[model samples]
Target: MKKFQITFKGQVYELDVEEIGSATPAPAATKTVAASTPAPTPVKSAAPKAAAPKAAPTPAGAQTVLAPMPGKIFKVNVQTGDSIKRGDVICVLEAMKMENEIMATQDGKVSEVRVKVGQLVSTGDVLVVTA
Candidate 1:
Protein backbone atom coordinates (compact mmCIF):
# COMPACT_ATOMS: atom_id res chain seq x y z
CA MET A 1 0.00 0.00 0.00
CA LYS A 2 1.13 3.50 -0.74
CA LYS A 3 -0.07 6.88 0.56
CA PHE A 4 -0.42 9.81 -1.84
CA GLN A 5 -1.70 13.37 -1.61
CA ILE A 6 -3.59 14.82 -4.60
CA THR A 7 -5.10 18.26 -5.26
CA PHE A 8 -8.01 18.69 -7.64
CA LYS A 9 -9.89 21.94 -8.25
CA GLY A 10 -8.20 23.42 -5.15
CA GLN A 11 -9.33 20.50 -2.99
CA VAL A 12 -6.74 18.24 -1.41
CA TYR A 13 -7.24 14.50 -0.88
CA GLU A 14 -5.25 11.72 0.72
CA LEU A 15 -5.57 8.27 -0.83
CA ASP A 16 -4.30 4.84 0.04
CA VAL A 17 -3.69 2.50 -2.91
CA GLU A 18 -2.72 -1.18 -3.05
CA GLU A 19 -1.39 -2.91 -6.17
CA ILE A 20 -2.32 -6.54 -6.86
CA GLY A 21 -0.60 -8.68 -9.47
CA SER A 22 -3.24 -10.41 -11.61
CA ALA A 23 -3.51 -12.02 -15.02
CA THR A 24 -7.10 -10.88 -15.67
CA PRO A 25 -7.86 -7.19 -16.21
CA ALA A 26 -9.56 -5.37 -13.34
CA PRO A 27 -13.29 -4.58 -13.49
CA ALA A 28 -14.26 -1.41 -15.32
CA ALA A 29 -16.17 0.50 -12.62
CA THR A 30 -14.62 2.66 -9.95
CA LYS A 31 -15.93 5.03 -7.28
CA THR A 32 -14.51 7.97 -5.35
CA VAL A 33 -15.48 9.29 -1.92
CA ALA A 34 -14.81 12.85 -0.79
CA ALA A 35 -14.72 13.92 2.81
CA SER A 36 -15.65 17.57 3.37
CA THR A 37 -17.88 19.87 5.34
CA PRO A 38 -21.53 19.98 4.33
CA ALA A 39 -22.65 22.76 2.03
CA PRO A 40 -24.63 25.65 3.57
CA THR A 41 -28.37 25.79 3.08
CA PRO A 42 -29.61 28.16 0.42
CA VAL A 43 -31.44 31.32 1.58
CA LYS A 44 -35.12 31.70 0.86
CA SER A 45 -36.34 34.86 -0.86
CA ALA A 46 -39.64 36.80 -0.72
CA ALA A 47 -39.56 38.02 -4.31
CA PRO A 48 -42.70 37.77 -6.41
CA LYS A 49 -42.75 35.27 -9.28
CA ALA A 50 -43.38 36.17 -12.90
CA ALA A 51 -46.09 34.33 -14.80
CA ALA A 52 -44.95 32.11 -17.69
CA PRO A 53 -46.55 32.69 -21.05
CA LYS A 54 -49.04 30.07 -22.11
CA ALA A 55 -49.34 28.30 -25.46
CA ALA A 56 -52.49 28.96 -27.44
CA PRO A 57 -54.80 26.18 -28.55
CA THR A 58 -54.51 24.85 -32.10
CA PRO A 59 -57.52 25.44 -34.26
CA ALA A 60 -59.26 22.56 -35.99
CA GLY A 61 -58.42 22.06 -39.72
CA ALA A 62 -56.00 24.96 -39.57
CA GLN A 63 -52.60 24.38 -41.09
CA THR A 64 -50.47 23.44 -38.12
CA VAL A 65 -46.82 24.38 -38.04
CA LEU A 66 -44.69 22.14 -35.89
CA ALA A 67 -41.21 22.55 -34.50
CA PRO A 68 -38.50 20.63 -36.34
CA MET A 69 -36.48 20.00 -33.20
CA PRO A 70 -36.34 20.67 -29.49
CA GLY A 71 -35.47 24.32 -28.91
CA LYS A 72 -36.51 27.65 -27.47
CA ILE A 73 -38.55 30.14 -29.47
CA PHE A 74 -36.17 32.98 -30.21
CA LYS A 75 -38.57 35.25 -32.08
CA VAL A 76 -42.11 35.34 -33.48
CA ASN A 77 -42.66 37.09 -36.77
CA VAL A 78 -46.38 36.58 -37.22
CA GLN A 79 -49.43 37.49 -35.13
CA THR A 80 -53.08 36.51 -35.25
CA GLY A 81 -54.73 37.62 -38.52
CA ASP A 82 -51.39 38.38 -40.14
CA SER A 83 -51.12 37.50 -43.82
CA ILE A 84 -48.33 35.14 -44.77
CA LYS A 85 -47.24 33.28 -47.89
CA ARG A 86 -45.80 29.88 -48.39
CA GLY A 87 -42.12 29.68 -47.42
CA ASP A 88 -42.33 32.89 -45.42
CA VAL A 89 -40.40 32.84 -42.20
CA ILE A 90 -42.80 33.18 -39.27
CA CYS A 91 -40.52 32.62 -36.33
CA VAL A 92 -36.96 31.92 -35.23
CA LEU A 93 -36.04 29.00 -33.02
CA GLU A 94 -32.75 28.48 -31.23
CA ALA A 95 -31.59 24.89 -30.88
CA MET A 96 -28.16 23.64 -29.93
CA LYS A 97 -26.88 27.22 -30.26
CA MET A 98 -28.18 27.44 -33.85
CA GLU A 99 -31.02 29.68 -35.00
CA ASN A 100 -33.63 27.98 -37.19
CA GLU A 101 -36.40 29.74 -39.05
CA ILE A 102 -39.89 28.28 -38.85
CA MET A 103 -41.60 28.99 -42.13
CA ALA A 104 -45.15 28.99 -43.40
CA THR A 105 -46.20 26.09 -45.58
CA GLN A 106 -49.20 27.66 -47.31
CA ASP A 107 -50.55 31.11 -47.98
CA GLY A 108 -53.02 32.00 -45.24
CA LYS A 109 -53.88 34.28 -42.43
CA VAL A 110 -52.42 33.40 -39.08
CA SER A 111 -55.22 31.94 -37.00
CA GLU A 112 -53.28 31.35 -33.82
CA VAL A 113 -49.81 31.65 -32.46
CA ARG A 114 -49.34 28.49 -30.46
CA VAL A 115 -45.95 29.30 -29.01
CA LYS A 116 -44.41 32.38 -27.51
CA VAL A 117 -40.93 33.86 -27.41
CA GLY A 118 -38.46 32.12 -25.08
CA GLN A 119 -40.69 29.07 -24.87
CA LEU A 120 -39.08 25.64 -25.03
CA VAL A 121 -40.66 23.29 -27.57
CA SER A 122 -40.00 19.68 -28.49
CA THR A 123 -39.86 18.00 -31.87
CA GLY A 124 -43.25 18.11 -33.66
CA ASP A 125 -44.73 20.45 -31.04
CA VAL A 126 -47.29 22.83 -32.47
CA LEU A 127 -45.89 26.30 -33.12
CA VAL A 128 -48.51 28.07 -35.19
CA VAL A 129 -51.77 27.65 -37.06
CA THR A 130 -53.00 29.25 -40.25
CA ALA A 131 -56.37 29.36 -41.91
Candidate 2:
Protein backbone atom coordinates (compact mmCIF):
# COMPACT_ATOMS: atom_id res chain seq x y z
CA MET A 1 0.00 0.00 0.00
CA LYS A 2 1.09 3.56 -0.64
CA LYS A 3 0.49 6.30 1.88
CA PHE A 4 -0.11 9.94 0.96
CA GLN A 5 -0.16 12.87 3.33
CA ILE A 6 -2.41 15.67 2.14
CA THR A 7 -3.08 19.01 3.82
CA PHE A 8 -6.56 20.47 3.47
CA LYS A 9 -8.23 23.34 5.28
CA GLY A 10 -5.32 23.50 7.68
CA GLN A 11 -5.75 19.81 8.46
CA VAL A 12 -3.61 16.88 7.39
CA TYR A 13 -4.74 13.43 6.34
CA GLU A 14 -2.94 10.19 5.68
CA LEU A 15 -4.37 8.06 2.93
CA ASP A 16 -3.67 4.37 2.49
CA VAL A 17 -3.81 3.12 -1.05
CA GLU A 18 -3.92 -0.61 -1.79
CA GLU A 19 -2.34 -1.32 -5.14
CA ILE A 20 -3.57 -4.34 -7.01
CA GLY A 21 -1.78 -5.63 -10.04
CA SER A 22 -2.82 -4.01 -13.31
CA ALA A 23 -6.61 -4.26 -13.64
CA THR A 24 -5.80 -7.37 -15.71
CA PRO A 25 -3.05 -9.88 -15.08
CA ALA A 26 -0.77 -9.79 -18.08
CA PRO A 27 1.07 -12.96 -17.06
CA ALA A 28 1.07 -15.99 -14.75
CA ALA A 29 3.68 -14.55 -12.39
CA THR A 30 0.89 -12.54 -10.78
CA LYS A 31 -0.82 -15.74 -9.64
CA THR A 32 2.38 -17.15 -8.14
CA VAL A 33 3.04 -14.09 -5.96
CA ALA A 34 -0.59 -13.97 -4.86
CA ALA A 35 -0.38 -17.58 -3.70
CA SER A 36 2.83 -17.01 -1.71
CA THR A 37 1.98 -13.79 0.16
CA PRO A 38 -1.72 -14.46 0.88
CA ALA A 39 -2.03 -10.91 2.13
CA PRO A 40 -0.33 -7.79 0.79
CA THR A 41 2.02 -6.21 3.29
CA PRO A 42 2.72 -2.50 3.37
CA VAL A 43 6.18 -1.13 3.88
CA LYS A 44 6.87 1.93 5.98
CA SER A 45 9.86 4.24 5.91
CA ALA A 46 11.10 7.31 7.73
CA ALA A 47 9.79 10.69 6.57
CA PRO A 48 12.03 12.65 4.24
CA LYS A 49 13.75 15.81 5.46
CA ALA A 50 12.79 19.14 3.88
CA ALA A 51 15.26 20.93 1.65
CA ALA A 52 16.37 24.48 2.47
CA PRO A 53 16.45 27.00 -0.40
CA LYS A 54 19.89 27.94 -1.71
CA ALA A 55 21.12 31.40 -0.84
CA ALA A 56 23.70 31.50 -3.63
CA PRO A 57 22.73 32.26 -7.22
CA THR A 58 21.47 29.29 -9.18
CA PRO A 59 23.66 28.67 -12.22
CA ALA A 60 20.59 27.68 -14.25
CA GLY A 61 19.03 31.17 -13.81
CA ALA A 62 15.41 30.01 -13.42
CA GLN A 63 12.97 27.82 -11.57
CA THR A 64 12.64 24.24 -12.78
CA VAL A 65 9.34 22.46 -13.15
CA LEU A 66 9.31 18.69 -12.89
CA ALA A 67 7.05 15.75 -13.46
CA PRO A 68 4.57 15.66 -10.58
CA MET A 69 4.36 11.90 -11.10
CA PRO A 70 6.27 9.29 -13.04
CA GLY A 71 4.96 8.61 -16.52
CA LYS A 72 5.55 8.48 -20.27
CA ILE A 73 5.72 11.67 -22.31
CA PHE A 74 2.84 11.80 -24.75
CA LYS A 75 3.36 15.24 -26.31
CA VAL A 76 5.14 18.57 -25.94
CA ASN A 77 3.51 21.93 -26.64
CA VAL A 78 6.50 24.25 -26.37
CA GLN A 79 10.17 24.39 -27.22
CA THR A 80 13.30 25.74 -25.56
CA GLY A 81 13.29 29.53 -25.05
CA ASP A 82 9.58 29.69 -25.91
CA SER A 83 7.57 32.10 -23.79
CA ILE A 84 4.65 30.50 -21.95
CA LYS A 85 1.81 32.04 -19.96
CA ARG A 86 0.21 30.74 -16.81
CA GLY A 87 -2.05 27.70 -17.33
CA ASP A 88 -0.65 26.84 -20.75
CA VAL A 89 -0.57 23.18 -21.66
CA ILE A 90 3.17 22.58 -21.59
CA CYS A 91 3.02 18.85 -22.19
CA VAL A 92 0.92 15.73 -21.94
CA LEU A 93 2.02 13.02 -19.52
CA GLU A 94 0.55 9.54 -19.45
CA ALA A 95 0.53 8.29 -15.90
CA MET A 96 -1.54 5.33 -14.69
CA LYS A 97 -3.16 5.36 -18.11
CA MET A 98 -4.45 8.90 -17.57
CA GLU A 99 -3.36 11.86 -19.69
CA ASN A 100 -2.19 14.65 -17.38
CA GLU A 101 -1.71 18.14 -18.81
CA ILE A 102 1.43 19.69 -17.38
CA MET A 103 0.79 23.43 -17.16
CA ALA A 104 3.03 26.41 -16.66
CA THR A 105 2.89 27.66 -13.08
CA GLN A 106 4.40 31.01 -13.98
CA ASP A 107 4.98 33.15 -17.09
CA GLY A 108 8.52 32.58 -18.32
CA LYS A 109 10.70 31.47 -21.21
CA VAL A 110 11.41 27.76 -21.45
CA SER A 111 15.09 27.41 -20.69
CA GLU A 112 15.36 23.66 -21.12
CA VAL A 113 13.44 20.62 -22.30
CA ARG A 114 14.73 17.50 -20.60
CA VAL A 115 12.69 14.64 -22.04
CA LYS A 116 11.92 13.42 -25.52
CA VAL A 117 8.66 12.24 -27.01
CA GLY A 118 7.72 8.72 -25.80
CA GLN A 119 10.36 8.91 -23.07
CA LEU A 120 9.51 7.88 -19.48
CA VAL A 121 10.15 10.32 -16.63
CA SER A 122 10.14 9.88 -12.87
CA THR A 123 8.40 12.05 -10.28
CA GLY A 124 10.43 15.16 -9.39
CA ASP A 125 12.74 14.70 -12.38
CA VAL A 126 13.27 18.07 -14.06
CA LEU A 127 11.02 18.31 -17.10
CA VAL A 128 11.62 21.97 -17.91
CA VAL A 129 13.56 24.92 -16.55
CA THR A 130 12.14 28.37 -17.26
CA ALA A 131 13.98 31.67 -17.29
Best by lDDT: 1
Query: Considering every candidate listed, which one attains the maximal TM-score?
Result: 1
- In the range 23-119, model 2's lDDT, one tens digit per residue, is 9634332234655576766444446555765334434568877899999999999899899998998899999999999999999999778777899
Q: What is candidate 1's lDDT per residue for 1-131, written digit by digit as tens?
A: 55677665555567977657966655655645566856657444434445766656666777899999999999999999999999999999999999999899999999888889999999998898889
| TM-score of candidate 1 versus the correct structure, residues matched by position | 0.56
Q: Please estimate how well model 2 matches the true structure, expressed as its whole-model Cα lDDT.
A: 0.80
| TM-score, one value per model | 0.56, 0.54
Please, what is the whole-model Cα lDDT of each candidate in the order they appear? 0.85, 0.80
Shift in Å, residue 102, candidate 2: 0.4
RMSD of 2: 15.2
Model 1 ranges off by over 4 Å: 1-57
